[model samples]
Target: MKRILIINPFGIGDVLFTTPVIRALKENLPDSFICYWTNERVRYLLEHNPQIDKIFGLSRGDIKKICSKSRLRGFGALCGLLRNLRKEGFDIAIDFSLDHRYGLISRLIGIKKRIGFDYKNRGRFLTDKIRIDGYADRHVVEYNLDLLGLLNLTPPASRNLELIVSDEEKEKARELLFKAGIYERDLKIGIAPGAGASWGRDAVLKHWPPKNFAYLADKLIEEFNSKIVILGDAIEKSIAEEINGAMAHKAIDLTGATDLRELAAIISCLDILVANDGGPLHMAVALGIKTVSIFGPVDPVVYGPYPVSPKHIVLKKDLSCRPCYKKFKTPVCLRDKECIKSITISDVFDAVRRLL
Candidate 1:
């Protein structure tokens, strides 16, 4: 049996973009054992996917955390992870990480065939690669599927993002909603105001004003009698609070309340998710829930909802410098984020209305 390893040490959206590739691999090579290597934080997202036979999680932050506690333990941990990969005897590795470090590690682990993108000439160690400057022309899902061609594998016709939500997760979400006083009959709408952990400190650059979100939530409540829930991580509780503070009506604050899997569960229970371009927005799309996503510097064509269907509405301003986020880099905006800030509340509310 062939052992194939897929490496993508990135955020939730980047990893989810590879789901179609995983599905294609499983369909074409049913007997192959597929292992996914990702950041520990995002490992939960792939836990329920049956196509992935095994998952290995390791990140620099994990190593740093361990090293901070004990240097010897950290070194041993790295060695142990590398040793385990060697023992797995993986034949081919499909790497989505543009970093050369993953390619070097795959080589050291004795993987014979390495396939990936040669971004900035980082694929020097890759045996076969497609050279590109960045994800500019097409959706990331299409870019990921392109790597399959190197293996002589046919890409799946349907390239929809895949996320498997367990039955237990669904039940837990229901319980959380019930406790929040959101009944089954209530029209549930989720708003994720944060830009996700991937953007780090620059997350604020992607955020529409919290006051705008507050106004939009109140409008949604008034028009549809919707139960709005503020969704985000613990770090984003302040943003949620700000939205709550500025709002005319109260919203169920769930920021920092659920883990990544539970967040998916909660999003699954929502009729529609209105979010800035980030992980939660993609999660909703993966779960087949409608989404009205706000885009700032990022281009919706390259990173928007995968299928370009009516179920997903993208709200953005048409400006030359708007999609400043190109080739995985965003330049400092001098326009005070006019791209995102220009997207009026009415525009977003109308998009949400279309989806609802």
Candidate 2:
């Protein structure tokens, strides 16, 4: 294929999962142009990526409209997006987003080869569908790379994910920290309290609560003498504020302040990152930074840190319905997210201590 378009207009972590496939495509099909389409907020995730030739940002507003109750607005926006994709004359279209809209749009745009997961038989919309039962007990990186099977090509040995942060970005990240009075001597702990599935959908769903994070931050400050920084987009500033407000020791709140690349660079400077099972956790793992992740509703097997390095530690409660996040957009848990509630501050404290 001369022109390949990967549609992954979703969360930052999901976009990161496709990095290996991008590298494989660039190495195996060296001459082809690979275009990455993702949420506008996450375009920075791919801009410096050497494997991807072009990074296209999809509007968050349009995506919300497409997923919202307003059918007329959603359909109109989808049609416009469909026309735009058709105009690109893509030789191959891959829908890593797994949302039916992108798969349907690929089909409607007349792409000969469209690939995606066939969850709940959405295979009707995708030309080449790979089916997997409930959440596959494997890392999401391997799951995303499975799409490459459509070309009858085997994956390369080195599946190391890539994120290119320029030296300039590194300098800026240091500057931001320096200005915050966080010297090089201080141990930095980054806390990303927001997840797209959690905050955008339901705060109580896939998230480990704000109070827990607040308590954890205080414990780190008191015990480890670590400087904490809360990371998230503007939409999550309120959540960040809640955590910061509840904390005894003040944390540098960079929520709604840094862009995606900036966030990546900042994360690179962290001694260890502590976060919920979401984007920032994946970002830290990819950057090769030590991370302590709190898992509740989501299964650690599916979304946990890949390559299972000692640097990445996941703390999850043992429960029969631990992965209830998979059952519905909002979990159907009767005990009010007891899975997350059960994971005490001491549990996370122990995990962070091990990494520190």
**Distance from true location, Cα of 276 in model 2, Å:** 0.7
Instruction: Looking at model 2, report the run of 10 residues with the lowest lDDT sum.
Output: 324-333
The prediction achieving the highest TM-score against the true structure is 1
Put down candidate 1 lDDT per residue, 1-356, tens digits, no spaces.
88999999899899999999999998889999999998889999998899999999986667778999999999998999999999999999999999898999999999999999999999999999999999887899998999999999998767889999999989989998999899899999999999657878788888999999999999999999999999999999999999999999999999998999999999999999999999999999999999999999899999999889899999998998878998877888899989999999999999988876
Off by over 4 Å in 1: none
Q: Write the per-residue lDDT of candidate 2 for residues 239-285, one digit (tens) a residue.
A: 99999899888999999898888999999999999888788888888
Best by lDDT: 1
lDDT of 2 at 45: 84
| Global lDDT scores for all candidate models | 0.93, 0.81
TM-score of each: 0.98, 0.89
Model 2 stretches astray by more than 4 angstroms: 59-84, 197-201, 327-330
Candidate 1: clashing residue pairs, number: 0
